[model samples]
Target: MTSTTDHTQQPREAEEAREGEGTTGTGPDAGSGAWDDGLIARRAAAASATAGGQPVVPLLPAPHTGTPASGPDGADDDLTARLDALRELTGLSRPRVDAATLAEAGRVLDDAAARRRLSRRHTVVALAGATGSGKSTLFNTLAGVTISDTGVRRPTTSAALACSWTDGAAGLLDRLEIPGRLRRRPVQGPDGPGPLDGLVLIDLPDHDSAAVEHRAQVDRVLAHVDAVIWVVDPEKYGDALLHERYLRPMAGHAEVTFVVLNQVDRLPEDAADQVLDDLRRLLDEDGIALGEHGEPGATVLALSALTGEGVGELRDCLGQLTSERRAAARRIGADLDAAAERLRPAYVPTGRVGLSEEAREEFADRLAEAVGAAAAGQTAERAWRRNAGRACGTPWLRLWRWYEARRTPGTAERPPGGTPGAEATAARQRVEQAVRVVADEAASGLPTPWADAVREAAARGADGLPEALDGLTAPEPAPARPPRPGWWPVAVLAQVSMTLLQVVGGIWLLGQVLGVFTPDLLPPVLLMVAGILGGPCVEYGSRLAARGPARRYGADAERALRDAAAGCGRARVLDPVAAELLRYREVREQYARVLDPVGGDGARGRAGGRHVRVTELSTTGR
Candidate 1:
């Protein structure tokens, strides 16, 4: 059966009156003056009604804003602004305070207020260990009362117990999530050495057991408590589950840890020391500090909770530690350090090569030359005319013209040299070859990836050039409108009549020459002159009829070539360079965001530097 005790101590009426009346002082009375202890206690009780009768707020006052009352509350305002700035920096939609930021806030709170609440200096030491480690006996011995059930039973201490110091250190109990409803008792010494000031000894349930909820409770309260005392007995000293699961994982918190070898009375005196030494060595190997052998690691003490041999020393040690107020800061600092490490990766720079302005300009220039926009347009005009002439006119017609220019009056055959159309065809081919050569040369020096992209873009741009040029150069097949019906036939009939007249005149002249007809025949010279003139007239009219189609074809071809050149320039050259430039801009923006100290929100001052206090709020509880 567990021993239970009731604490009947109550706040004195005179002390309560002093607490109700607010005063400007830096002592315990300050917490009392601003807040009614009874009211706070009642509120805590009401809040904890749903959670297994556990008070959420306990009797602790809210942490005070330790701001100074000078310079128009500048320090208080500054802290508020800084916190707001930090909030903006994180860009968090919810109140997601990291461990580091929480620690920083705690430090700020510590600096801004005086120690008016005795709880500020108090430490909550929880005894946590595996099952069958004799932790119940240790708890009872430490409390100087049989507060927990310790027997030969397989399991003990199902619920937690709170052993408080009589030095009015109830605030620490509240911070640790221990309620006033928990059984409390005072520890006594042979001379009744005054209570272990500001220490709350908590006897927690076995962490490894069938009662999983009991273990969860221990974990939930561990975050709020100051220090932890892990108890282990000789039989379970080298337990793999305990060391691997708890001791090794908490190696970073070497300062506030206390490892005790309990039930040492079961071992021989000489073997007890040896086993204790071995346990310390094992902890050291697992990265836990042990004694002063290394940097002040966790202190190892051999104790028999059953015999109560080391109970006084343990109590004295707990008192001294609680008085120093090291546990809260140490625990908070470790959490903060871990959080800071996690944030480091977010600021690291990713690799990217930077491009210079001169390089970009050079690339642009090369691309401009490759497309040959201006030159291609001019060359296309001449090439289109030559190709159109050969496609529309007959080779024999060209041959006849060449012969007409070279042959003397009575020549029977044409000259050996080819017609003008042949020379024009050759010239057209040369122009196309030149265009290809210039385009290739201009695209030669670009970076491979960009070069490929530009080439692909140019090819897509020029895809329609061939069809556009064909449409532009196609000859109009529709016949020209005849001069009104009657006039067009009359002109054709008149030409036929003239040709018949000439033929008749020629026949008559031949007859006159043979002396078979009268000597008054039409002159052959006149007939010949008429035929020659008529041939030139017909040729000129034909050329006049075809002029519109030829002009239209030439215009269309020129437009097509110009469009193709423009498309190639845009896709192959301009687009790739522009994309590269845009990529550089994106990279630059990302780097700027990482390096920008003020988070780019137009906030005041730099982000990282020595912190300056902005404001001091009234520490008096409202």
Candidate 2:
């Protein structure tokens, strides 16, 4: 048995105050807040009432919300949970699913909640049909009184009328908006107790009436009723308006529906049977299944209110429905099924893909390429070589190169040879393409609207990315030209020594020619040859040594630029795409919960493992 000790621990006055926060009046437009408060209060009171006894109810959360509380039964919980899931799913899918598309679902939930809160014990059944269909006659026969006007009228029943077999249904009648004068109770006879003790029969306005308000009234009352008996005669049984507008759309509501062939007494026995068979065929075409071959579906019966042919059978069915006290729940479940079927396209997908590692890596690579990382590395290597030559070459050559640079028109230290504007434009294009690729992959197989939303998010994230990348690669004072190596001075000194030897040799030769000194020509010539050969060798060695460090410096520059590019891509595009995907996943789960009632696959009319099955209503009086 379910326990209510935790709930009972709270003071009664405090609990009442909390539950009564927003439920001052039970008006027609009170909305769902009043229903929630009423349901909570009733469930709490019921739990406390049965706590001391051996209650059959199991410990479960309330149906409307997932809050842990004692509930009446699992069937009620399942219906409530599915309704709650649908509401939440609709909210989560906003901007993707328009509010206008979900108007039917909203009405279904509001009506179910209002009905469930009013009175679960009473089974509210509506008699609905076209004008001159003998619905009022059948209703009067069922109530055993002349309550409704019956004649050869073109249109009747502009307002709803109610007849309760027992008392204490004022709340339910009020919810249906039935006028006080129109509400009636059956007079007690010598029979001790009637079969239908808690039945609330409603006579609705004619659906095919010319008056628009009468049709609107029929629609409003039908939405709130627990079950409906569609009364049709032989001629109008296959009317296209009735089938297309009502029967076809409510195919999921077969369990709570009964198709009656009224005025059968007007036809011969053979003709009556033929009309009934044809009516069954028409129902089949409208997607309403009959309880044939042991399957639970709608109950079809041929009857005549004038002769009282099948009134007893219909009463027995209503009696059974009221005794079980589950018609309201079954009807609510069917409404949920119909609403969910309409919404399946928006929430459920054929298939989908996620943000993969390969996609991210490819995006990063494209960004690196866009920023010209390879070109930057090559430039760094060339810069290193030029700086090294300036430091280690002979002083005269270095001075001449500097003078030549000053003479040139556009020889100032710049980053590279490319046009800055052109490179920036190409980089922007690559960045945009990368963003689109990743966004498409992430949104694959999603609904068209949601996919558009994901792509929009990616576009927003890519804004200003090109300018950011340019800032990272922009030139900034040439990095102070890397410090000279320790061995550079040794090479410079060797070159200077070679120059001194050549100078001294030339002077000696000149003096010899002038007869000022007695020197050999061989020594002077040999010194001159040594200076020429040594200078070239030193310069060659310096060039060979600079290759290793230049390569290392180029590699470092490439790695730093690539890292910056990858970071910018992640911050701008990838992260936003991932967030949108996560949100879609969350809403999808909510849809799944709404799709299934007993948390099984959402097959129509299958409520597995529940105490109350979805198709049990059709089999109630068989």
Candidate 3:
């Protein structure tokens, strides 16, 4: 037979009973081994760690043979997978999620691990209610012993008092952070032997206590319990402080929750039923379902804690609950549900964020302009023409060479040599402008924080890009001269022919002047005129023929510089920004998968499509 009585409570109970037999010291028998209340209570509490022997103390014929320590593993495995996903998400979202939010969600995982390591043998049930609700009395009555103090003052319970049903749950209690002084064990009662074994009951201080510490203690202990029995009386049942502040918020925890109407003995049976019905309606409005596992209803029960009236029904319910021993899992499951719900806002958005192709091309053009690509192309075209003029222009005139050196202080004429530093500076300015353009485009339409990240990413390696581009442009080579035009030889020959005529005319004219025999003077003078006139036309035609090569050189230079600038922009800015975007998108997808419901099986405690800030602990405290 399985007995889950606490190992620590029996010895204390025996010691207290032993001391109570002695006469009171205040009645003139004080010196004759008489025991006072304070001394007995203290002595009972001071029992050694080993004073309580075995955990189980039989109270009746046990129907169950084995401890319920081994619970169903299917739910446990499923819940573990969910928790694993939750932990992973917590780590992944650190860049965006605040520290406090992570800390709050993080506690669910920590508590889950702690609960698993602690005793699975005992179900930690808490009796929580406002002051004057008779929760303490109910706790003592449930344990079949008067362990908690019942009072009429505003706040009777100052701290949590725990009564464990079994011996092996000491580790579990320790994990709960309950001090040993405040812990107790239940002594068996005489009414047909109450059947509550493997149950750890706690009476919590009033949540609305005026003393901050008392309320804080209650809040702290409330976070660690496996199940909660909200002990509300007739008056406080409809209290807004209890319903609105606590019950409504914990709707997802309906599985492990119980709404018990304490002090129902004061109300007639029909009246009690009506109040129970009203409480159920309120719970329904709060979104708490009515039932456990597949069972339905809020599991509402009415009993008078002080009179022991209708208390048997409460005991039987506890007996079955303790025997099942899956309350811990249910409690953790509810915690996971709430945690998942809180994280919905971060992952719920869909669609990828990226720069359009048109936007990219425009940005590249801006970068090219910033690097002086057009100016460089034009300079290349002019330089090509200058080289052509030097190589194939009329040798006799050489006017193109002379014109190239026509330098003035403020003119647009090219210097005999180009300045590298001045060109680099111009390119640098263009690069700066390009950076702003690309960053702004990439960040457009993004949320403020994401936009900032995009801009930062775009500018990540911006400093080195200009220098790289400058190095590329510095070695700019002149375009190959276009194959000389097909008519270039004819033009050159015509010029030579015209010059010969002039030479012939000059010799004849000189001879005539020197009184030597020569051609007729009229013919010589006409030949000179024609030769001079034709020379100008031939030179003009040659310049015209050079235009094709000049334009080609300009286009080639523009292409090269544009390619270099584009490469610079891609390497330094666009690639990094794209990477950041992809990262954000990937994280969003991972979050979606993590939060997605598993096979539509809501049984695993997933809260679909709910979002809320986790600034405060859930109404469940943890």
C-alpha lDDT score of every prediction, in listed order: 0.49, 0.70, 0.64
Residue ranges of candidate 2 with Cα displaced over 4 Å: 1-73, 95-97, 187-193, 350-354, 387-403, 406-418, 429-444, 481-552, 597-622
For 1-622, candidate 3 gives per-residue lDDT tens digits of: 0011112111111111100011111111213232222332333233323425832211111111122232353444444444544554555455655666566467776776567656665888888998788999999988878899987777888888889766777776776677899888887656533467788888888988899998787777778887788999998898887877677666656556678899988898899999999988887666666664554334678889989987888788788777766677666656765665555444433223568787789878977776677888888788767665654555566664466546433455653434967766766887777787778877665444456777888777687888887676665454466445566677778878888888888888888888895546898898888888877777777678778878987999898888888887898889888765654443443343333323233343433222121111111110
Candidate 1: regions farther than 4 A off: 1-64, 68-118, 167-177, 188-195, 291-294, 343-622
Instruction: Give the candidate order by descending lDDT.
Output: 2, 3, 1
Error of 1 at 385 (Å): 25
- TM-score top scorer: 2
lDDT of candidate 1 over 1-622, digit per residue (tens): 0000101100110011000111123322233334222332344354446655643322222224443222121322332222222222232201222445334333322321222233444667889888889888888777767788877665577777788765565665655556787858665666543546667778888888778878777766655566789899888889997777677766655566789998888899999999998998888766664546444446788888878888777777787676655555444333322322233232222322223444444433333233333334444444444433433333345568668857756664332335746744543443344334333433344323333433454445444433333343334563343122223344345455556656777787788889987886446657755754564464345345445544555456455545654454445444543443332232222222322212333243322211110100011100
Q: Measured by TM-score, how close is model 1 to the native structure? A: 0.44
Q: Write the per-residue lDDT of candidate 2 for residues 495-611, one digit (tens) a residue.
A: 898788778888888888898889689888788788877777778899899899888888888889999999988888887777666556655655556544443332333332221
* Top model number, lDDT: 2
Alpha-carbon RMSD, each predicted model: 21.2, 11.0, 17.5
Better structure of 2 and 3 per TM-score: 2
